[model samples]
Target: MKQRIITAVVALLFFIPLVAIGGMPLQLLAAAMAGVGVYELFNMKGLEIKSLEGVLAILASVLLVLPKATWFNFLPDTVTNITLFYLIVMFILMVPVFSKNSYTFDDAAFPVLVSLYVGFGFQNFILARESGVTVLMFALLVVWSTDIGAYFCGMKFGKNKLAPHISPNKTIEGALGGVICAVVVALVYLLVWPMANYNLLIMLPLTAIFSVVGQMGDLVQSAYKRHYGVKDSGNILPGHGGILDRFDSLLFVFPLMHLVGIF
Candidate 1:
């Protein structure tokens, strides 16, 4: 816990300035995030997509994010474009070979999932930058509130399990508190940041909805770790485990916020 706090401080140390500056710095940040996400993803599935296939997937993910960096007028809306990309990738996965006994179909799912997940999630960071740094700040706040609220509320009042199969520790009381914290954070930020032209009602409930989804995101990662019988995604970010470990919730939030046009 202490290590996570220190790591977050270090992250803010670098993250705040890059995001504030926008342009290449933010774009570089997005690229690095995309790289880490792709690495973790391909590793997670245990599907060995290597050589040309791996490079192609990584290249596609970067290209998927580049449009978000530039203020390109022709770039499609972030949410629909990303979600659609996921569908396109899924379709790519369905392509069959001359024989079902062949290894081709077995390998198809990895690159597709990596391309879509890393591509979509990382690109949305650019959308976050569109609304200024405060938008990113609020996204962080919503996720943080959910984490903290769930911890305290679960300790104090939890009885029912949220999903015993996926995340045994998560509880219904914790989920409720997490949502409430998300809504309160949205409301408070709206009151404080008069310059941010966000729709408070939309932002508030969306925070709650995304917070729940974020919890699911965390559970998804936890499931991955459990599946692999490993601890942490990687040690890339000390004290925080890995890039995915820290920003697992952000994956869900960035795309969801884009869907609601919050950024």
Candidate 2:
């Protein structure tokens, strides 16, 4: 618990600044996160990171997440997107044909999937950040509130397991508590940051939906870890495990917000 608190505080201190700065800083942050997250995911599959495939996978993942970044300002958006997509596709397709021993179809597929997962996830995150810092911050706060609320609520009042196979720790009562807590946080944010211009009626349902999605994201990651027979994604964040462990909910929440036209 102590380690978890310290890790969260340190993460907030570092992340808040990048989020506040926005633009390239946030893009770079997302890129770095995608890189590390892809590495950790590949590691789970027992893949070697020093290999050519690993390097390209990480780079492709980072590039996919850097759509809003200024690094490619010289190129047109369409061109940049196409070039990156071509590069990633070529690498994935060619590797299996050229390097049959070291890289197989399974190996090739992992990078592509990882790229799409982390890339698309962080791309939506960057989109949210580009929309406005306030919108991004609200999305983040609601996810955190749901997590906190569920943890305490589960510990205190949980009686039935929500999903015994996927996530034994979660409870139906805890899920309800998380939704309630997220709604309260959204309401508070609306009051304080009225400039967000959230319709109270719309915001309430949005908050509840996001909270549920966030929890689903958590459960999905948990299932992944369980399938691989691993405890945490990585030891990068000490108590938090890895970038994936910390940002799973954030990844899912932002995309959902985009779909709902909130971002």
Candidate 3:
């Protein structure tokens, strides 16, 4: 518990400043996170970090994230998007040609998927921040509220399991508690940022929806680790686990915000 609190504080110290800057610093942080996340995923699959496919996977992950940096603002969005896609396709093609069976279809495909998953997910963070600090901070705070609400609520009143096989700690009551908590936080934020222009009725459902999505993202990462026969993703953050473990819900929220045109 002490370690967790300490780590959270340390992270906030670094994260708050990067978020305030809202540009290349944040993008570089995102790239570093994606790199570590891809490495952890590869580690789970028993792959060498320095292997041909592994290096490509990490590099691709970093590259895919770079286009979102503030420096790349000069380029058209269409150009950047297409270029990354083309490069990813070429990377996949080159895998089989350069090294037969050293990297299988699944092996090659995994990194690309991770690149899209982690890379584009964080890219959306930059997009969200660019829209407004309030938008980004609101999304983050809501997710955090959901997690905290669910933990305490579940510990006190949980009964029925939310998903026993995937995450035994979660409960249906806790899930409800989490959604309600997120809605409350959203209301509070809107009250403070009164010019938000979002109706309470609409905000309630949106918060509830994203709260559920955030929980689903947690379950997905849990399932991933279970499939790989592991517990935590890595020990980088001590009690907090790895980049993926910490950002799983955040990752899901970012893309969803984009889908809903919030950013």
Q: Estimate each model's TM-score.
A: 0.82, 0.93, 0.92
Residue 256 CA error for candidate 2 (Å)?
A: 1.2
> What's the number of clashes in each of the models?
0, 0, 0
List model 1 lDDT by residue over 1-263, tens digit each: 88878987988899888877987778877877887777776676664446455655766677677653253446566644445455555545545443353647657766876677777787887778767788878888889899989989998999999888767888999989988977887788878874344566656767788899888889888888888776787788887788788778888888988887777
Q: Candidate 3: TM-score? A: 0.92
Worst 10 residues of 3 by lDDT: 63-72
For TM-score, candidate 2 versus 3, the one ahead is 2
Which is the winner by TM-score between candidate 1 and candidate 3?
3
Model 2: per-residue Cα lDDT over 244-263, one tens digit each: 99889888888889888887
Off by over 4 Å in 2: 80-83, 195-198
In angstroms, the error of model 3 at 125 is 1.1
Give lDDT: candidate 2, residue 124: 86
Model 3, C-alpha of 177: deviation from truth (Å) = 1.1
Q: Where does candidate 3 clash, by residue pair?
A: none
lDDT score, residue 221, model 2?
87
